[model samples]
Every structure is written in C-alpha cells, then in structure tokens.
Target: MAVLTERPAAPVRRRDRGARTLVNRFLGYAVLVFFALVFLYPFVIQLGNSLKTQEGAAANPLSPFPDPLTFAGFERIFAGTNFPLWLGNSLLVTVLVTLGRVFFDSLAGYALARLRFRGRAGLFAAVIAVMAVPGVVLLIPKFLVLNQLGIYNSYAGLIVPLIADAAGVFIMKQFFESIPVSVEEAARIDGASVFRTFWSVVLPMARPALITLTILSFQGSWNEFPHSLVSVQDPHLFTLPRGLADLVSGSLGKGTQYPLKLGAALLATIPVAVLFMIFQRYFVRGANEGADKG
Candidate 1:
C-alpha cells in the first residue's frame, strides 16, 4: 500500500530487441539448412544411384532413393577391375609419403624456425615462393627431372617428389614458432641434444600439427592422379584414383555404366571420410592455432 501502484510496465524496447534477435536466429538457421541440403544433395544422389541398376541410375540420375537396390556394381568393381592392386599401391604410397612428409617437413620446419644459419631467411622465402608456384606448371619440369634421374616409371618417382611439401613445411614451421622458446631452452639445459630435444620434448607438444599434416598427406597422396599418371605407366602400379579414372573413361566398354563408376567412387571416398571423422578435433585445433600464430 506504500506505493499502491506497480512500477510502470517494463519498457517495450527490451521485448522488441529480443524479438529481433529471435527473427535473426531463425533466418540464420534457415540459410544454414538450405546450404547443407545443397551440398549434401550430390553425395546422396551418388550413394543412392550406386545401388541402382545401370538403367535405373540413368533413368533416375537425380534421385536419392533407388527403386530397387543391387550390389552388381560393387561386385563388378572388385571382380572385373584391378581395384585390389590399386588399393595396395595406394596404401603403400600413402603410408610412405605421409611418413616422409611428416618427418622431413618437420625437420626442415624446425631448422628454419629454431636453428641459426646463414641464409635461413632466404631459404624460408624460397619455400614460400615454391608454395606460390602452380603445380601444373611444375609437372613438365618434374617429368623431365624424374626421367633424367632414371626413376620416372617407378615408385621412387611417385613418392619422392611428393615427400616434401612446401605447405607442410610452412605449417610445421608456423606451429614450431608458436611454441615458447623457453621449452627447448629447458631441454637444452637438461643436457638434451638438439635432435633429442626436438624428438622427445617439442614433438610431443606438436601432436595437433602432426595430425593435421598426416591427414593432409594421406588425402593428397590418396587422391593423387596426375603424379601417378606421369610417374608410373604400369597398370600394376596404379593407385585408386588413377584406376578409378581409367575405369570411368571408356575402360569398361560400351554404354555408360554409371552404377559401377559411382560405386567405385563411393568406396574410394570412404577411407578419407573415416580418417577425417576420427581426427576432426586435431584438425580444428591445428587450424585455430595456425590462425592465432599468424
């Protein structure tokens, strides 16, 4: 009874602001869902049509549900093609290349980041320059160099050129620079040699960067076609990508076998997809750290 009147009802502005925010959030979600559908649409179609008969796939190219599913395409992929051999080769090359990239790139990156040497700045600048060059332009030069080295049509050609990537080196270098120098100094104080310090002390802290590099190396080497095309002419040495390309482009005689090709493509994509899913956290962390360091 002291005031006998309720404070004037709350101002309308607060409710108005909240309504605007709600409207904005709804529009944002609408846009995100629309784009998600657009991007996922093709993968859905591929997966669905891969299960369909050739006739069914051709008739319903855009459909995401097959009327009747068949495994004939998958059966043909293993039985009618050199998929197993390609898989083996892809596994070998990807493993070797990933190992080499992670080791050599990290070594070079650490050198550039921590080691004092003449022309260190120049060397890093050269790495940056190499990154700027288009890969297509280097193909011819790479071919000539490989031919001269007498390893052109061998695994050496396939693995060696790819083992050291400027981008990987840059990524490792950036990450190494972000680590506090005091950590390495402490290792040094504790009687650790440079290599031991790097291998034991610093490398453990670089798991995020290493995982990022591994994913990149695996994906790049797995999907590599142009390098394999030029590096090895032997059908026995073909990787999954090269084999898949040959399969799609008139290798399977006569009319378009969309089901078989799509099936093979789908299988080829699964490994990388699985790897990404497994290490997505490390990849995101590496990217964020890289951004902050930059």
Candidate 2:
C-alpha cells in the first residue's frame, strides 16, 4: 500500500523540480539582460551624440537621437587638429612596441619554461614579483632611469621601456609549458640548435598564444597614456591617447563640445575594435587553452 502511494508522489516531486528550474533560468536571463543594458547604454549614447550638433548635444545631453545630424565635428577633427600626426605616431609606436614585446617576451618565456639555467626558478619568481608591483609606483623610478640613460623626451624612451612586460612573459611561459616536451626533444635529437628549434618547431605550434600576446601588446601600447605623459613632453611625439587627453582637458576652449570629443574618441577606438573582431576566434581558443592549462 505504501509503495503504491509513493509512486504518485514521485511524479509530483519531478513537476515541482522542473518548475523551480524554469524559474531559476528565467531569473538568470533577466539578470544578464539587465547588466548588458547597463554596460551598452553609454556606448549607444556616445554614438548617438557624436552625430548630433553641439547645441543639440548640450541641450539634450541624455537623448539618444541627434536633433540635426552634422559632420562638422568630424570635419574639425581632421582639418583643425593635430589628430593625423598623433595617429601616425601612435601607429609607429604601437607597431614597434608590439613587435618587440612579442619577440623578447617569447624568448624570455621560452628560456624560463625550458632552459636549465642555474637560477631559473629564482629568475621566474622575480618576474612574478615584478608583476605584483603597482605600475603607478614605477613611474618616478622609470622617469629617473630614462633621464639617466639619456633617452628622456624621445621616441626611444617611449618605445624601449614598454617593449617587454612581465605579465606577457608570464602568459607565454605558461602556454609554452603546456606544450608537449616530446616535440622539443625530437627537434633536439635531429641536431637542431635551441634557437632553431624554438624559432621553427615550437613557435609555429604556439600560434594561439602568439595571437593572444600580439593582441595584448597592441592594445597596451595603443591605449597607453600615463607612460606617454611621463616619457615625452614634446607635442610632436605625442601618441593618440596623449593627444586625446589634451583634447579633453580644455584644449578646445570653454563649453562641452560633445560631438567633437566623442568623434575623436570613437576614431581612437577603431583599430582595437577591428583587431578584436578579426582575431576573436583565436582569442577565445587561447583563453580556453589557458584555462585548461591552468
């Protein structure tokens, strides 16, 4: 008699469980949608206002539609400013910095990950420790070193210091260690030099990690501002971020020129946007591999 009653209760319990799961899933989606809107709303407003006239933007600051669309702000950005020169300088610095970081960081990472040096463990620990130090604390020390090295206020000062990053070295080392050791040993047995093996055999296999490193280096160098502010005082050497900062800081005179400011900012973000869009697949793969390796 008890078994016959319990069978009926089993169906009721499953129905209740299914209802609870459905409610939880609905709540989860609602939370996700809410947060997405919170983050996306500002970008929508920025785009909308960039096309608006100055008077329209000022009067209806929160409005998402331009009262009367105008391209004068963009016109001024190209015609009335040093934005082109800044863009050129930014491109030059970003390219060099990205290349240097990819090469130097990968070499150091490979050495740390594979080479049997006397103090390899200690050196890697030191690299990890350096990453822990706040970037702000290094500004004064870095400035003093650049001054001493006679590279202050030059392109060399800006480019050289940013070439190698401890976090980047750490990322490369982690990914390199995750690779199969047998592959490297086969190259060694075939009489390949360590550099030759690393350059030819190992590097090609590290495409995901290399792509990850390249994007990071490009983004870091492209959006860099504080380093530029401290390293070079000359307007001619200013990168896009530095120039954008100058534009925002009362450079265009009184009143909020929202259209011009937003337009400039939008232009500054395009390269990074394009880069992420093109390489998003590799980035996702690298992230998954990193998680597995971790």
Candidate 3:
C-alpha cells in the first residue's frame, strides 16, 4: 500500500482563507468608519456652526470649521430668547414624568405579572394594542381629552398624560416575569403582602429595569414636542422642543440665525446625551434581559 500524505496544497488553501478573512475584516472596518463619519458629520457641523459668527455660519453652513468663533449665539440664547424659561419647563416636566412613569408603570407591570385577576390577559393584550397604535393617531383624541378635562394649556396636561406609557409597562412586566416566581413565593411565605413583596423585594431587585425606564421616560418627556403643541399654547409652558420650533419659525428676528438655533439645539441634546452615557450599560443590560424574557 502506498503511504498517504497530506496534500501540500492544504497550506496554500489555509493561506488563501486567511487572506480572504483579512480582506473582509479590512473592508468591514472601512465601511463602519465611512458610516460613522456620515452619521457624525451633521453633529460636527452643528457644533462648529454654533461657535461661528452668524455671518460665518450662514456662509459656511456645511463647514466644520468656524471662520470667526463667537459666544454671541449662546449669549443671545440666554439674554434674548426665552431659553431659560423653556429649559426650566423642560426640566420640571421631564422629572415629573420620569418619576410618575417609574412608579405607575412598575406597579401596573407587577400587577399584571404576578396577580391573578379577571381579564388580566385581556388587559395585557389591550396594552399591546395600545402600543401598536401610532402616537400621532391619538393626538387629536388626546387633545380633546385634555381639553375636556380642563387641563389643556397647563402643566397638568403636559405631565399627567405622559406619566405612564404602555411600552414601559410592557418592559417592566417582561422583566418581572423573568424573576422566578419562587422569589415572590418566599416573600409571601414570610408574610409579605403583595405591595410589600413588590415594593421591597421585587422592586429592589429590579434596579436595571427601573433605570432603563427612568432614562427612557426622561428622554421622551424632555424631547416631547407634539404633545406640548397640543397641550400648551402658552410660551411660558413651552418645553425645549416647542421653544426650538418657535425659534425656527422666526420667534427671533429674521435671517437663518443658524448659530443661535444650532446652539439652542445643542444645549437641548446635552441632558439626554449625558443621561444615556451614564446609564448606557444598565440600559442595554435591562433591554436585553427584558427581550430575553419576552
């Protein structure tokens, strides 16, 4: 019998495979870098324009370098516009909405997850249906309801309607279900009431989900514009988004006012960016956990 030997061509095949992988990886990285620059280019322009003089910003709107840097835009933001008032309203609405959503959504989620009740499944299905409904579709109904309730054009309208969202409830319920029922059983055996079990035992263990909810709620409320448009026509009650809209619609004197507009938008984005950065890991982990449970 002839002794069989591994083909020397095997090494050449291996080298070919290695070369293909290297090429693919380089191409992948190049693609990623290209998209990253594309996505980030507008933000770079925004920042640069915000620092430029009005004339320079109007002239070089697409440029990422300011010909003559100035703080006049930001200064005008505080001194000229109603930015301070808008900022305060935004902060207040965001805080209240975030807190209310966290508390109410968690409670609703726990009830849905652990409680036995008539029509529980139906209620959850309804929540799912609500989630499916486009938010804009509800705008007219929401406006009517707020008007009927005599809360329109008031902080109550702005804050109360957003306190609990179907998505938050869905997220919390999924996360709660992921916790073994045995844990709640243990708490029950120790004579913990339903509220006690949920509040102390379950809620404490639900830090990740809560953080995720809080961040979402804060961001949503902070960036809310349509609701504000329908809820409050009063300039004093205007949030950052509504105020920005007004600014864009020529609330300030004529000309693009690119520097001032971009500056205000930049400032509006900072809070959400900071919050996301701080809780990014927690948010991702919570979202993954909730998704897995679902």
Candidate 4:
C-alpha cells in the first residue's frame, strides 16, 4: 500500500486572511453608517420644523420637535395658496416626461447599439456634444426655441422638451453594449425584426437597467425647477417649482412663514423619497452602470 502521508501543514494563510477581511468589512460598515447619518440629519430637521408654527420655527430652527405641534402650516398650505393645483401639475408632467423618456431613450439607444446605419457614429457624437451643453446656459436658447415653435407658455412647451435627453440615450446605449451580441444574433436567426426582438426578448432581460432609468427620470423631472421657470409663465400653467417660487417671492405677502414653506418643501419631497426607498437597489445599480460600461 502506498503510504498516505498527511500534507504536513495546509498553510493557515487563508484563515488569517479571512479574519482580516471580516475586520475590514466591519470597519467599512461603521464608516458608512456615520456618513449616512451626517447626510440624512438635515432632512430630519426639515420634517420637524415643518410641523412647527412660524414663531416656533424661527425660535428653534434646529429643533427636531415642536413644543406644541400645530397643523397651521398644513392648513395654510391647503387654504392660503394653490398648493393642490401645483402638486397635480407636477405629477402630471413628471409621469408623462418619465414615460416618454423611457420609450424614446431606449429606442434610440437600441438603434445606436445594434443598427449599422449611416451616420451612426456622427449621431452619437452629436448626442455627446448636446449632453455637454450646460442646462443653465440653455434658459434663453430654450425659450427662444419654444417661442419659435409656438409652444411657449403651454404644457407642450414644459413637457415636450424634457422627453428626450442625451444622457439618458447614452446611458441606454452603454447598457445595450454591455450585453452580448450573440443574444441579438439568436433572435435574428428566428426571423424576428429588430424592434420585435428588442421589445420581446432584450427589454425583458434589461429590467434592472430599465428600472434604473425610470427612477432617474422620475427624480430629475420632478425636482426640475429652472426648466419650469423658463418654459411657462401663466400661474395656472405653472408646475410645483414655479408655483413654489411665486409663493416665496412676495406672493404670500406679510411674514416669513417658515413652517408653511418647509411644509410645502417636505410634501414636494415625499413622492421621490418614497420611490427612492422602494427602488433603492435599482438606483445603486444605475449609479454603478456607468462604471460597468467603462
């Protein structure tokens, strides 16, 4: 019989390395928790102050609770201004814009990624250049375009321009590139057209990427203020940001009503915050998608 000698010493190196890794992971989590609180505490303060009265808020700006909690702020928000209307308009615009972007962006992205069409490179280059243009600088230029198109001061002006974004297209294109070409080839072998393949097979596989794009579009259009400011002028046509700006700028007329202001801001934040909480994982993936594409 061959003598089976025990391996003298399975090197204990792996065991030592794993212990070090566990310790490092623990420390990393501790650091992350610390920073999370640092960033999140202000929102906590805002929520608390929003419940206080004007005097209470002014007296204790940093307090997270009011001595005598009041709904005066909320009542005022409902009664004193057109808060409900603004909220409704914001919702309508955001939903339409998000849906439009998800469709248009993915369509364009698929074409760029899979179609060997004329001017494909040039079109993508133009998209990159468009994305480089600063949004603030486009205020006057966008206004001019809207006026020229006869959509200014209308809902069309507000919602149409936001439907297609270069960055969103680029994001989708990069994601499509990360997928293997064999999948598309297989679909083609089955005699499926490009759109049919993309809609049936590819898009379902791209659920994670789609969710990320959806969340980004929702947050971006919901929080957009400058675009709304320049797009429409009529109070009745105003989105939440436009109405909110009008509310703060002498429209409310007398005192500095911090509670009411904070209340409106807090309410404005809730939808996106809820969406962020629910789709937190998708958001994380989306943020990292760019790195993966690179």
- Predictions in order: lDDT: 0.88, 0.89, 0.89, 0.88
lDDT string, candidate 4, 1-294, tens digits: 224423344347557778999999999999999999899988988888888888899898888998679999999999988899999899999999999999999999989988999999999998888877889999999999999999999999999999989888988888888888888799999999988999998888777678889998999899999999889988888888788888888587555898898889889899989998899988787677646543
Residue 235 miss distance in model 3 (angstroms) = 0.2
Against the hidden true structure, what lDDT does model 1 obtain?
0.88
In angstroms, the error of model 2 at 158 is 1.1
Per-residue error (Å), model 1, residue 62: 2.2
TM-score of each: 0.89, 0.89, 0.91, 0.85
Better of 1 and 4 by TM-score: 1
> Which residue ranges in model 1 land beyond 4 Å of their true spot?
1-10, 253-255, 284-294
Instruction: Let me know the TM-score candidate 1 reaches against the reference structure.
Output: 0.89
When 2 and 4 are scored with lDDT, the better candidate is 2
Q: Residues 154-193, candidate 3, lDDT per residue (tens digit)?
A: 9999899999989899999988998888888999999999
Q: Give the TM-score of candidate 2.
A: 0.89
In the range 1-294, model 2's lDDT, one tens digit per residue, is 766657756888878989999999999999999999899888788888888999999888788898898888889899988999999999999999999999999999999999999999999999888877878888888899999999999999989999998877988999899999999999999999999999999999998889998988898899998899889988899999999898888478656788988988999998998988999886676567446533
lDDT of 1 by residue, 75-144 (tens): 9989999998999999999999999999999999999999999999999999888877878877788889
Backbone clash pairs in model 2 (N, Cα, C under 3 Å; residues 3+ apart or in different chains), count: 0
Name the runs in model 2 displaced over 4 angstroms: 1-8, 17-23, 281-294
Root-mean-square deviation of every model: 4.6, 3.9, 3.9, 5.2
